[model samples]
Target chain A: MGEAIVVTSGKGGVGKTTTSANIGTALALLGKKVCLVDTDIGLRNLDVVMGLENRIIYDICDVAEGRCRLNQALVKDKRFDELYMLPAAQTKDKNAISPEQVRDIVLELKKEYEYVIIDCPAGIEQGFKNAIAGADRAIVVTTPEHASVRDADRIIGLLEGSHVESPKLVVNRIRPNMVKSGDMLDIEDVIQVLNIDLIGIVPDDEHVIKAANNGEPTVMNPDSGAAIAYRNIARRILGDTVPLMPLNQKKGAFTRFKKFLGIGG
Target chain B: MTVKSNHVTIKGIKDGLVFLLDDQCEFSELLNELRYKLEHSHQNILTGPIMHVDVKLGMRNISEEQKTLILDTLKQKGNLLIRSVETQGCVPEDEAGSSLHTLCGLVRSGQVLRHEGNLLFLGDVNPGGQIICSGDVIVVGALRGMAHAGADGNEFAIIAASYMAPTQLRIAEIISRPPDEWENRESSMEFAFLRGGTMQIDKINNVGKVRPDFNVFKGV
Candidate 1:
C-alpha cells in the first residue's frame, strides 16, 4: 500500500503546494509511484505551480462525484513517468466532498501507487478535515517568520487530534544571509516553536521563481541553492543519510547580488 | 421496567432494563407504558433541557435476543447513558472526550472564544494564532502572532504584546506593521490602541510625573 502524506500548513503563502510538487516529483524520480492530490477546491494553485493547469480536463472532484473515472483525472507529469497530478476542481466550494470520500479515494489510489501526496488548503476548516482524513503521515511547511511558524504549530496540533501521527516539518525559502544579519527568524527559532521532527530545510533561491515561471521544478536544476536542498531532501526521504548542507557560510550580499546579476563578483 | 419519580429501576443492572420478558409483559406493552410516562412529564423534547435516561447494558441470565432488543430500544431514543454495574463507569467523563491523554487546549483552532470582558494568554500564541477580544489582551510571553482587540466595533479594545512584533496588529481595523527599520523599535512592552482612528503603540511605563495617561507593559 502507498504511504499517504498530506502537505499542509494553516497559513497561506508558506509553500505547501510548491513543496508538494517538488517532493512528489522527487519521489517519482527516485522510482516511486507518486500521485499528488490538490485538496484546495475553489482556489487551486498546484496545477499552476506544476504547469499542468491547462492539461486538466477532469479533477479529483470529478472522480469522487462519479463524473469521470479516477484514471482519467490523473495527469502524468511531463518530466517524470512515475509522477502524476490529481488536480482539484476550481468551480466547486470545499463542501462538495466529505472526509470519508477523500479517504475512499486515497485507499483506491494506494492500491496503484506507492506514495500519495495531498496538498491541503490554507485554513483549518472542512477542506482541511477532508484533506487530513486519510493521511497516514503529514508534512507541515513553514517559513522563518513568526506568523508562518505559529500557523504551522496550530496545524500540527490539529493533525494530532485527527489521529495523524508524526507530521514532519519542512522550513522553506530560508535565506541564510538575512538570518545571519538577524533580520529574519532563523531555522532554529522556527523549529523550537513548531516542535516537529525536521524533514528538510530548503534554501531560498531565485531559480525557484524562474523554474516556476517555466513550469519546471527546481529539483531538476543541479546547482541552484533551493534545487540542491530539494534534491538532498529527496535523497534523505529515500533513506540516504545525507547531512544538511552548511547554511549562511557565505560572504557579503553585495558580492552575491553581483553573481546573481552575473556581473563578475 | 418500573419507573418512580422519573427514575427507571430495572430488576438487575447487569442485563439491560429487565422486568420479566415473560409473555405477560411484551416489548410493545413496555413501550406503551413508557410513552405514557414521558408524555405526562414536564420536559420539552427538542427545545428544552436534554433528558438523561439511565440504561444498563450487558447479558447474564437474559437471552441474547432479549438483550439485543433492549439495546436496540435504547439506541432509538439516543438519550440513554449506558452505565455498567460491573464498574459503574458512567460515560467516562474525560477532558472533553478525547481518547488522547493530552490536555486539549480549551481554545481549539478555528474557534474564536470572544470575551466581552478581559482576555489573557498564559503562553505565547504562535502565528496562524489570533485573539480578538473586546477588552485588553495581556500576553505572558512575546506576542509574535496577530491580535485584534475590540473586534465588535468597540474602540475600548487594546492589544499589548511583550515583544510587540505581530504579523498583523489591529485595534478595530486600524492596522500597523512593526516598522520595516527596527532601529527605532521600542525596547519595552508596547500597547497598540486607537486614538483619532489610528493605531498607536505607547510604551508601558510607571512614573510619578503624570505620564501618558496609561501604562503599558515594558520589555526589559
Candidate 2:
C-alpha cells in the first residue's frame, strides 16, 4: 500500500540528494513511516546527509547479496523514530546489484513503510535504472539553469517512458534577485523547459550548504528559505492545498491584496 | 600469383584469434597466405580452444571481388566468422567526411551526436543533448537541445527545426541565445543561419524560394 518515489535528476550536483534528504525528513515529521534508500552505490552520500552514516553496520549490498537481513541494514535516525535509511555500499561497484534485486528490496520495504523515497544516482546508467525500477512515482529535482532544466526534461521523458505517471518538478537553488534581473533562468523558464508539474521551489540559501555540511538536512532549519518550501511541498504531497511562498515583496498590487485577504499568501 | 611473403599474421585475442593482413601486400598474396595458414594450422589454432578466428584486413581498399574471394576461402576451410574488415584509408570520395546521418530517436540528455556532414534528426533533441555537424542540421521534431551547425567552420550551414527553442545555438563561430521574451513562442518552423557576422533566426514562411547558401543532399 506504500508509495515508492524515486528522486532523480539526469545531471549531477542539482540537489537530488538534498531534495531526497529534506523531503524524507519532512514526511517523517508528519508522522508517516518513511525510509530513504540510497542507490548511488560507489558514491553514497544520503546516509551522510541524513546524519546516519555512523550507525551503518550493514548496507544495501549486504542485504541484496544475502549477507544480512533487510532490517539489520536499515539504520534508524536519531531525530525521528519513524524514519529509517538504507545506506548504499561505498566499496562496491555499481554493477554489484541488479535492477531486480533493488525492486525486490523496495517491494519488501514498501510492506512496512508508508513512504519509501529512493535517491537515484546521476545519469541513465545501471544505477539510475536500478533506483527507479520499483518506484510508483518520480520527483525530478533541478536547478534554474540551462543544463539542469534540459536534464530534467530528459528525465521526465524517461520517467514517462517507464510508465511512471507524471513526474513532479522541484526547482532547487533558485536566486530570486538574479531571476529578477534576467541574469538567470526564472521559475517560469524552468517549468517551460521541463514542462512538468511544479511541486516545490527551494531558494538559493547558504544555510542549505551549512546544514548539509553538518550532516543535517535543511528542512530541520525552520528559519531557512529552503525549509519552508520543502515543508510546503511535503504538505502538498500529503494532499493539502498550500500556496507557494512569494520570493520577495515585489508582488503586484492585486497579488498583495489577495495575500492580505487570508485566502492565499 | 606466386606470393613469397608471409602477409597474414594471427594473434591471440580474448574472444578469438585475429589474422592481420599487411596493407602493402596484394589481395591475392594475402588471400593465399590466409588459406595456407588456416589449412595447415588447424590443430594448433582451432582444435582444443573454443574460439573463432577472425581476419583483419587493415587499411586496404578492398573490392567486392576480394571480399567474396576471402569469404569463400574461409568457408571452404572451416566454419569461421569474419569479425571485421576495416578499411582505414579507403573511404569513398562522397562518403568521406561528408555524408548525411539521420538519428531516428529521442536524443537523451548527456548524449552527443557529432558528424562531418549534414544531420537529419527525426525526433526530439531534449535539453543537454548536443548535435554538432559540419554541415546543415534539419530536425523533424522539437529542438530543445544545444546544436552547433557548421562545426568545421562552414558559416553557410543552416539549422531548421520544427520547435526551435534551443538552449544554445552556434553556427560556425557565432553563437546566440534565444531572446528572453520567447515564452509565447510558437511552432513556426524557424531556421538559423549566419547573416553578416551574427547568427540570425528567421521564420520559414516562404518555402518556395531557396536561400543562396541552401542546398539539399550535397556534400563532399
Chain B of candidate 1 vs. true chain B, TM:
0.41
Per-residue lDDT over A65-131 for candidate 1, one digit per residue giving the tens place of the 0 to 100 score: 9998899999998878888889999999899989998999999899999999999999999999999
Can you tell me which runs of candidate 2 are displaced by over 4 Å? A249-265, B1-125, B128-142, B146-189, B192-202, B211-220
> What lDDT tens digits, residue by residue, belong to model 1 across residues B92-198?
22211222111113232333445554466655655546777655566656666677776766564567656766667777667777676533586687677676787
Instruction: At residue A24, give the lDDT of candidate 2.
Output: 95
Best-performing candidate as measured by TM-score: 2
Q: Tell me how far the alpha carbon of residue B42 in candidate 2 is from the true structure, in angstroms, after superposition.
A: 90
Every model: iRMSD: 3.6, 2.8
Give the CA lDDT, 0 to 100, for residue B210 in model 1: 19
- The clash count for each model shown is 7, 0
Tell me the lDDT of model 2 at A41: 98
DockQ of each: 0.16, 0.22
Interface quality of candidate 2 as DockQ: 0.22
